[model samples]
Target: MSADHAHALPAGVRPPTYHHFEDLAQQEESEKLGMWAFLITEVMFFGALFTAYTVYRNLYPEAFMDASSKLNWKLGAVNTLVLIVSSLTMALAIRAAQTGKYSQVIWQTVATMIFGATFLVVKYFEYMHKYHDGLMPGPTLFFTDVFGEHTPQARIFFSIYFAMTGLHAFHMVVGLGILTWVLIKARKRYFTPDRYLALENVGLYWHFVDLVWIFLFPMLYLLGAHYGLGH
Candidate 1:
């Protein structure tokens, strides 16, 4: 339904219902439920990738380890830390929205976006380094000596790496876009304590994105380190 507000609302009360929703409470419930449902689907999608990664890792343990080591764990670790802090800020922004503190929401959202941007920037540099090293998997890949007899399997590992991390980064970029919308609404004082479900939904998305990274950091960067298997 179009977001056109009901004909009547008390002064300063944001319109809380669309035509299909019985009241503000119903609207809030529906929106929150919708976000949860969407998140469940995302969980299943990533689960498939995790399953594939695990199967392949078992099949070619050494090649996976070797390919993983070519990655800069230090940079991955920093991005992980950055995203953790961004999750904190996202939570703070949601809290601020709940408390009707528009100023806090604005600043907190800005902090979240800054941290997210920092992550993408770090990732950009990492991608560039790979490009220069020819570690990126494709027709032009040149890391044969590094993996010795396991070059082809190592290539497969990098394919999974790029698919997983690249997808994760793409989600972060989308989250940033959502944050931008939330920031704009915040500046307009569009959300009040009673009508901030949009902000809450955005928080859900931001947290989910961060959670994916938390898993990814270990899966991609910590695998080789755990067994003392790679340089």
Candidate 2:
């Protein structure tokens, strides 16, 4: 919708509908609130997965550590760095929106997309390596080899691994789509210093993505530390 349409709100009355809010500030606030609420639910959603992962890891410490060792920590670490930088740039993009720096906002969002793409590229390689090794979610080659014959329980660990990481990666793709749209809108100056609800909402979503990785890193990569795997 165009700014002209935005100003067509009833006098002194902004609809509680944030996307249609006449007052830009009110819209931004509503967007932020809605984003936070959505993020809270996301946290809970991933939290359940994390809890299940933890329980399984505890159940088979050796198998879990062995599985963890199979992961490419170097790639994981680099992707973590990329995402952290992307989060910083995303936050800066929001600040740029607040200041009405349309070009800066567009570029920052573009930079974030690049970093996000890099992360996905790395993830692609990681997934490819695992798949080629037959380490997918199933009772097939993923087990019986990677986790050692003694560690049958590790198959369950890898199952959760694929499910959790796969879902997280899917969210990254969604965020990338949102950022791309925001970039186009920013380039067209759809967001004024007063009316950048889209930017604010996307920022909130991006931050939530980062937060999920914060938990995933420790849970997936660092969970088996200090455990005696007998490897």
Candidate 3:
């Protein structure tokens, strides 16, 4: 197609071609590769924390298990389901964008945002409970009293818990902002079936965040549940 014709195409119907790309497909491929590379960096970022947790957990298995029991698994499980549902909605939004269903895209994006907000609300309560119980990462009174013989080790477990979950929560907050932006753009019909690269990339990010929680829930909350390590 001529440059003028490509430029005149309705929003979302045709992908935009970048200066370096010979065609829209090439541009899209380049964008996808860039996003994947960024996600790889994100993986390494979280992987480091996972490594630290593994080393510490091994060093103090009993203390770690004991600290794990203090967390509210029921709430963690609920949040897991919420995030999973949000991921589903995000996927649906991307599909809608791909199909040129702008209305569906808006609704699905809004739904995903709602689910994400709900997850954060639940997380707020969980954190508040921890604060009230004096479970803030240091050698606090609750930590000392609850894990008298294992205070030092248990403190390490709580530290990891807060660090991991806090980082995850921060990502959720970022996802919320992304979804909100997507919602606004969808309302303006910014995405079209052939050119919803933004939606696709954001969906990939939301999915990655959700996937992280999947591993986190099992590791931080359910690992030793059968051994009475869950509250």
Candidate 4:
């Protein structure tokens, strides 16, 4: 390669060079490996929570089933669909970034954020319903009134419910922030066919968040659903 070509930024990539890597390919690989490592840690964190949930659930089977029945499955199902759609849009955004379709990248990223926000809004209503019904994690008269003798055991289920879903929601919020940043950079045309690591990395994170919710929905909302649980 010529001296000028070696020093010059790749076509469509803006200033602030990736200092640690010799070229775009190395940088991209490093970024991907870092993201995968972070995601693996996240998986372990969620796995521990799931293990605890399973243990408690098995120990208090009837109470857990009864508690699960109280959740609105319809809303959970709807949010699940919304998140899945967001993951699709995130993937599309990455594709657009790779193809240098800046306009499509912006639109797809915006769509993904909208879907993510929709999920949060639905989650808000769900939490509000639990609050009004006194189904929150702590002590409440509603549990006693509704579950009667099983109130203590029911609280344990709700505790795990809040911990898992609340953590997932927090990740969604973080993902939204990441997407917003990507949208801003994208508007500046800071990405190109050869250099769009930010978009790709954020896409992976968004998909990971969506995958967590996919598991959460089934575990928290659909367990023992055949036992006459209402939506």
Candidate 5:
């Protein structure tokens, strides 16, 4: 048989295999499944931080409360609200993408990114305040004022607070990066009404981030705020 009849072999060119579904749909489903797996791991990752926090708080109630009192609940609460709004926007973005509303998806994604950035900015200010006040959790410095001279347990409280909040902030940064990629793809109109798994998975991730913050707010901020007193 001639070369043309022998599958038309070309240098460095490979024949494509026929898939049951089109490439785009297959890719979309695969991406969605991958995102769900990633979210599950994220849950486990944050779970460890929470467990550590619980252990420390249970061991040093007074020190924990003292440290918790120093946190600016007003700022934390505002951030919580910001993240909640972002979650809603992210979900809406997914819906927009599913309905082939490219403009809406792009705008909603931008809105979500803005809220994510706002959360980071607030967290930065909080960290700055803590650092300036010498509230770090260790013998390095600043524990005396934060926990009083006699209380050594304050270090533990600060340790857990830093661990939990810092981890959450890192995840927020990751989410922002993910959203940036999604925005680029959305701008290119890569997603269609029937194949928008990327948007949906990112929505799941956004909600998970929001959920983690919901738990963190109460655990790190409200757990020891005079609720356990006189019990």
Candidate 6:
């Protein structure tokens, strides 16, 4: 594509060539590799937190179970379902972008944002419940005698729970912002069947966020299910 022709294309649709990239395929591959590299860093970051939680749970299994029992598993499950649906919609949005169906892309992305917002709303309620119960995992923490002398150990569990889930929620907010930006360009009639590198990157991120929750829902909420505490 010539300079004038490339400039004439919709801004959100990537050009067929750039000064740095040999061709559209090379540009697309570079973009995907960059996103994957960033995602690997994210995985390492989350992995450290998971490792810490694992060590603590192994050392204080009873305390972990007791603390996990107090969490609202039902709310966690609801959030899990919300994310699953959001992932589906996000995938559909990418497919639409690939098919050059701009309208479908917009609606599907909107569905993704709505479901993501729903997950956060449910999380807000859960946080408020814990806050009201003095279980927010801070200097104000008061686990009650329900946890007995294991309260201290359980405090560790709450701290990690808040850290992991709070980070996950932050990611959702960021993903929503990206989707909004994409939606704006989409409204302006951007991207063609072969020019959706940004949208593809966003899809990878949205799916990663959902995958994290998939691990979190079971690790944090369902650990004590057999004992009837998490159920």
TM-score of each: 0.90, 0.83, 0.91, 0.89, 0.82, 0.91
- Tens digits of lDDT, candidate 5, 1-231: 122222322233222324754775566566778888988899999888888887878887777787777788878889999999999899889877666677788999999999999999999999988887777654554436535652567777777788888888998999999999999988876555655665687789889989999999988777555664321
After superposition on all C-alphas, the RMSD of every candidate to the true structure, in Å, is 5.2, 5.6, 4.1, 4.6, 9.1, 4.2
Error of 1 at 2 (Å): 32
lDDT of 6 by residue, 1-231 (tens): 223334455555556587898888888899899999999999999999999999999999999988898899999988999999999999998888777677788899899999999999999999999888777877568534457889888889999999999999999999999999988977865755657788889999999999999999989998777788543
Please give the lDDT score for candidate 6.
0.87
Off by over 4 Å in 1: 1-12, 18-22, 226-231
Off by over 4 Å in 4: 1-22, 139-143
Error of 2 at 221 (Å): 1.9
Model 3: weakest 10-residue lDDT segment is 1-10
Clashing residue pairs in candidate 4 are: none
TM-score of 4: 0.89
- The superposed Cα distance between candidate 3 and the true structure at residue 33, in angstroms, equals 0.9
Evaluate model 2: give its TM-score: 0.83
lDDT of each: 0.85, 0.78, 0.85, 0.85, 0.78, 0.87
CA lDDT for candidate 1: 0.85
Candidate 6 residue pairs that clash: none
* Model 1 lDDT at residue 70: 82
Q: lDDT score, residue 185, model 1?
A: 82
Say which prediction, candidate 1 or candidate 6, comes out ahead on TM-score.
Answer: 6
Highest lDDT: which candidate?
A: 6
Query: What digit string (tens of lDDT, one per residue) describes model 3 on residues 1-231?
Result: 123333544645665577888988888888888999999999999999999999999999888888888889999999999999999999988888766677788999999999999999999999889888888865453445678888778888888899999999999999998888888888887877667888899999999999899989988987558877447
